[model samples]
Target chain A: MGSPAPERIVRFSGTVRLAHWLLASTFFVMLFTGMCLYLPALSRLVGRPTAKAWHLWSAIALLVGIAVLLLIGNRRSLTGVVRDADRLDQDDVAWLKGGPRRLFDHDDAPPQGRLNAGQKLNTMVMLGLMVVLAISGTLLWLGERDTTYRFGGSVLTHDLASLAIGFLVMGHLYLALVHPTTRHALRGMVVGDVDRAWAERNHATWAMSESVQSAERNA
Target chain B: MTANAPTPRPGGRPIGRAAFLGTVATGVGSIALLSRYSGSVQAAIQKVSAAVPGVNQIAPTAGWRIYTVADQMPTFNAATFKLKVSGHVANPVTLSWSEVDALATETQVTDFHCVTGWSVDKVHWEGFRARTLIDLVRPAGNARYVTFVSTEAPYVDQLTLAQFTAPGVMVAKKQDGVALKQEHGAPLRLVVPAMYGYKSVKWVGEIRFDAKRADGYWEQNGYDVDAFIGRSNGLTGS
Candidate 1:
């Protein structure tokens, strides 16, 4: 009989998975409600008042969820992502220059850590955008409550940031769902683990490092 | 009156003095009822106008909520209302509604953009150009800014001398083909089409040309002094 298949690698912790889903759900709700408010054609379907309420509540929830995750749920994962995103070594630069084609071609692509170059760039952009959106959205809400609270060009900033985030979300979804090579990536986020073979093939450097650390611990 | 007018046969109808008297009474009674009804209708309309002032003049396309700091609108007699233009000018002048209206008038259909993410497009405004007032006052070379003071509220707004003199800026008196209502600044309100709505002060009573920049009501509260559309306040893209 063939040897038993290798155990799956734990790609995401339980806290990380929980935080990801909460954020995803909140973001989707906000996006839907925001689109209803922004598009005149869709406004009638959802109604402006209802859509506005949902959008505001969802935004608040997203912020709260992020705070909870950072402060209580999984500080280690959050810090790791943030720290790794900031440091782009030569390999990451090479990966970025090689582009997605190189990733798909699988022609000796650069070894990556927990996050690849694309994900690092995405994380940085998303972090900046989230900060902007939070500030702008709060200002907008205050302005709505009282007209006296007029912040200059805040409306434009809110609109532009929201649009950028919307596009980013779409791109992220496509990569995780539609891309042939990355379609199975969603399982890792959902189940918190990835098949050993897949992890070895896609994240060879990370897999090797994890194995070495496990060996050291065992020894 | 004919004393011997034809007498009515059985069921033929009454004639002469009694009939004439009846007809006269009916006519007077109908006239009284009509006048009373018209008076009540007028009163009802006035009550509605008092409750929701300027509801009729608001354009359907004006999609923004009205915002006022003061709970009550400032009361002013249009006939006695005076707009004083003073400070840093060759000639300081005080003009009444008639005098202001007597100057050249222009009508514009433009969008009124509030900094708070809402905009009203195609607002029809009829008023005298700010240039006409500026020409009359003739700001001195030392003047760098223009400050607008509200007549009833503790609100003030400032604009650069260049912005005040720019085209499309005016002291608007009418909106949507009717006289501007009390809630909408009544006699005169400043209109700066290119800038945010706060720069356009409502119920403007004074225009002061200043040598130095002065903070407006919002500007004093952490808002940018120069509220140019999409350009001011470090809101440009990354």
Candidate 2:
């Protein structure tokens, strides 16, 4: 019997993968330093000033990296992800109703686009949270330098955003690394590709569309 | 499920529902334990502060930020330092540092909130209560406000009669069980726990009971005159 065809497909572009990893690292640094700043006991491990410096610098780096990637990297792919996330149809609604169990049982899930319902939801939530964090963090930094630039709500916003994002990140990590079925999804972020069979099963609608476009281009 | 479906490798090791639940449980348990430990540490710090004389709070010095309006901190001669209590009072007195220190001392543990969004909690302030000084030079019925003048800088702030005589408001002489440093308004500084740090003027050289409201340095520069804690300066609901 002949061996099956190679089950591999380009799932993410190089720029997307780079941005993903960069953001992941930056997020971890921010999380650690931010925790240090929030919890007084943890502040003893790394002095408050050092933790503050790390948190501020990492936040700046994250913002710069995001801006650079959007400006110079795969703007098309970024826009596509955003557009796809925004376009949640009946299938996404059905998937949401079926809940996390359907996520584990891929065959039970409704056919999805390039991004799944959960991923779309995550993207939107993270986007909103990032905007809040950025604005609040900037206000806090400004207040630190110039006492006159302070706003009372800035602290509340920054603190709430940090905690919410931290919890969201935990859930994100659990699904990407610990969940029985979705753990393989991390590969798409790391190596920029996923097994074609896995993609066909998980994202059948997107895979079928890609195949039709490829054939049309070839013809 | 497809007949030809490939086995999913979860980072090379399969994690079952029990394992996932276990991980989450452990995480939550660790957090709870850490918080409990933190509470114990806080209690211990408070205990230590209470044991030490002239200390009523236990905020770490590292948490405080030195803020100056003109980017300048002035030095003072402790030997020549005098606290002048005048204006709308029955007896106007000019007392030296020794005389001020000789007054009935009070200790209070309170949170020092800054308008700039940072707070130093559980600060041990040991000094003469504002009521003591107010009583020493009983204010005239017309005296509705009290003005604090900083000796080193051109900074000034005022408080209403009620606010000036409120409980826990004092002129602190020592902080964290030691003499107040110059950077922290050495020899004498006002500690208004119920108001923002800006209203707690450092290097207090004079206290004047006034007939009308007087704007301090910060108030003239757009800050609220009544810098009440969690009330003025947009700190409400925060």
Candidate 3:
């Protein structure tokens, strides 16, 4: 037999992988349907009424889907993501301060826990943008019923939030799918594990501490 | 011969004038016959177009949704109506109903659109082309923007001179071969095929050529000034 398989580290649990895929799929659905509603040419292709129905229904599905997934998924691990992203330790501050240099060389980044400083910012900002979009989108839909909603700047706010979300999502895709060093990051979200060596090099503290293995097994 | 009744050239030779006149008479007779039964033709046209999706939304009685700032359409009278042409024009003359009708009649068959993603296609419109009005009241060299005031006190809109005078832009007096109904902007209304219906001010009472741009009622309330059909409304930003 070949040498024993290289030890694997659980970078993400099954629940986290499912959540990642769920969010990623919904992001595309919203992007494509939102575009249909935004561009007049596309609106004519399927008819405006049809496009509006699809966009509205898809948004509802996404909001409901996330709520249901969180309720059914591993409570500790799922909640841990929020907890980790919320609190910024000294290493996270240093990592954030590292700025542009960290993008070029991962080694310049501090030995962060499971969640990094950049990821924390991305998570917080994305959540804030979603809240803005939900409110503005609801107002825009109500504009047909009353002109008051039209005067509320809901259209401008919805469009601006969508643009910001799209920009951040593109950056996220670049790291997962295109970046040379972080290309393996996709595997953690896909298979719920990463090579022990890759984990040691990128997330030395999380891999060496075996903190994820002990805490996440219970999850 | 009437242009519509011209005979096809045979052996590369022009037809005789008498023969042409005879052909024209026949064409005239055919037109009379068609008009005698035009009711059926109109019914057929309506039947086919109404079957098409997004086409049945312009009926005055049912389809079209009327919006008025004062909760009513401004009353119009052909006899007393006057459209004042003032501001940056060399000739600031007022036109009566007869004077307005005296200008050459131009017609168009194009789609009319509302800002709310609704449209009425192939609407037959008859009016005096904007160019005719431009020639009658020559705007000053410095005049750039055009403003229109509706008979309704609060309903007003503005457009650039180029947009106001573009092809298919007209001071419409008739729609679908019928005098405009009161609800649809009777005596005269502006018809702008290039922009949404809001820019096409109804019950037009005043036309002004000004040097500076002024916001319309909707624009003052946060709507886009240049409301082009697809590219405007702040939906897309460069």
Candidate 4:
């Protein structure tokens, strides 16, 4: 018999995948709503009627997505813990110095599990940013929440948060557009699959660990 | 997972053509119903009515929200606060707060709008009208714009001579029945109900009439310059 295709690599469960896309879609909506309010140039294009409606509605949608993610993915899995992901060991240091090219093509890089340390780090950063954005955005929206619960900070603080978010978005765009292996991450989200070769090479530890667990369960 | 699979991704839908058509039809129907049900006439009036721009002040009538920033008390010291009124004038003069305040007291009640959709109505503000200063300084005939410079460096706003002299425009020293709160704008602030809140420059220290117009901070950062208070008014400089 002809050799069968290798078994598909399932990186995320159905609930996890659903939450990811929901959150991702909500992020774009929230971004557009905030831009409409912040940038008069955009406000003019949307006009007040559409812009105000879009801001309020999209914000509500963003909240819903975040709530869904929190409900589904809030557990403290080993993956959720900060330590394993945040370490910028020698390989990461080297990759940073050489620039992103070495990290892509799965060339001359250290073995990583289901998610590489960098991917984990990115996830952590994204989570933290979303939390901050949600809280600060709420304060800005609701107007003058109790000073005791103040997230308005100073005008400078608000401006700095905006700049930081802008930088994070730029970094996200760079990784998605510039890096090949991480570029595959986008397709994974869209198609809900990653090639076995891609997964084994980039996330060998994770793929191997998952397979071993499956074998144990079957045996 | 393999790149190709017959199974749909999470949250993916079949989205048949019939369903798509149904969605479009529903959306159009809802819009039509909303247009018919909602007060389009009021919206039309809000657009084309000849009523004065600040006629409907929300702050006075509605209990809108206000956030207070910590006060930088006594922002202007007669010893330190010197207003340098220069540019396109025969003689440049720097007046102290006491000197400026001693000029004719001009109070105006006008609406204030932030680009972020918050509007305060009929805020009673008191200040020396720029018109009074314009009269005193006798800006050169070509001086067609006024630039407001604040102690908070790098924030600036420019106004055309016509808008600069608009009725109820003031270099406000007070707001809402009190000496202007520091967070609101203390020492001196510009209050123009007809424009967006950023146009109401806070902590204003200097007013310069310019022969040439200059871009304000918000304008450079992609906000409208002549931010008119009508619905559907696009955010672009005339």
Q: What is the interface RMSD of candidate 4, in Å?
A: 18.1
lDDT, model 3, position B194: 81
**Cα lDDT tens digits for candidate 3, A1-219:** 998988776667676677777778877877886665565334334434565667787778777877776788665666556555566667767887899788787876787655566776677667667766776677667665544454223443465467778889999999889988778878888887778788777777667556444555459
Which RMSD values do the candidates have, in order?
30.9, 11.5, 25.9, 18.5
lDDT tens per residue, model 1, A1-219: 799876776677666678778878988898787765554435445645567778889888878887887787766765554555566666777777888677469757787755667776776677666666676677677765554444534554555567777788898999899986666668878987777677677766666666766676579
What digit string (tens of lDDT, one per residue) describes model 2 on residues A107-215?
Answer: 7888876677778777766766666677667767776555456665465456556766777899999989998777778888887667777878888777776666656
Candidate 3 error regions (>4 Å): A1-3, A211-219, B1-238
Quick one: ranking by TM-score, best first? 2, 1, 3, 4
Report the C-alpha lDDT of model 3 over B1-238, residue by residue, as the tens digit.
0111111111211112223334334333423433233334334545764777553332211124344455445677778889999899888999998898788998999777666544556788999876887898899998999999999778899988999778889889998999887667887888988887888898999999899999887777666788776556643433
How far is B163's C-alpha from truth in model 4 (Å)?
Answer: 18
Candidate 4 lDDT over residue span B59-80, tens digit each: 1112233321221222556567
Model 2 ranges off by over 4 Å = A1-6, A103-106, A145-149, B1-166, B171-191, B197-226, B230-238
Instruction: Give lDDT: candidate 4, residue B108.
Output: 71
For candidate 2, write residues B45-81 as lDDT tens digits. 4566567854432132224655554334556676887
DockQ for the candidates, in order: 0.02, 0.06, 0.01, 0.03
Task: State which candidate has the highest lDDT.
Answer: 2
Q: Across residues B79-137, which tens digit of lDDT does each residue of candidate 1 receive?
A: 88898999999999999878877888899998786665456667999998768877898
Question: What part of the reference interface contacts, as a 0 to 1 fraction, does candidate 4 reproduce?
Answer: 0.01
Q: Which stretches of candidate 1 lie over 4 Å from their true place?
A: A1-6, A146-148, B1-112, B117-238
lDDT of 3: 0.68
Q: What's the CA error at residue A98 for candidate 1, in Å?
A: 0.4
| Model 4 agreement with the true structure over A127-189: per-residue lDDT tens digits | 555544544556554433222232213222333345455667778777767766677666556
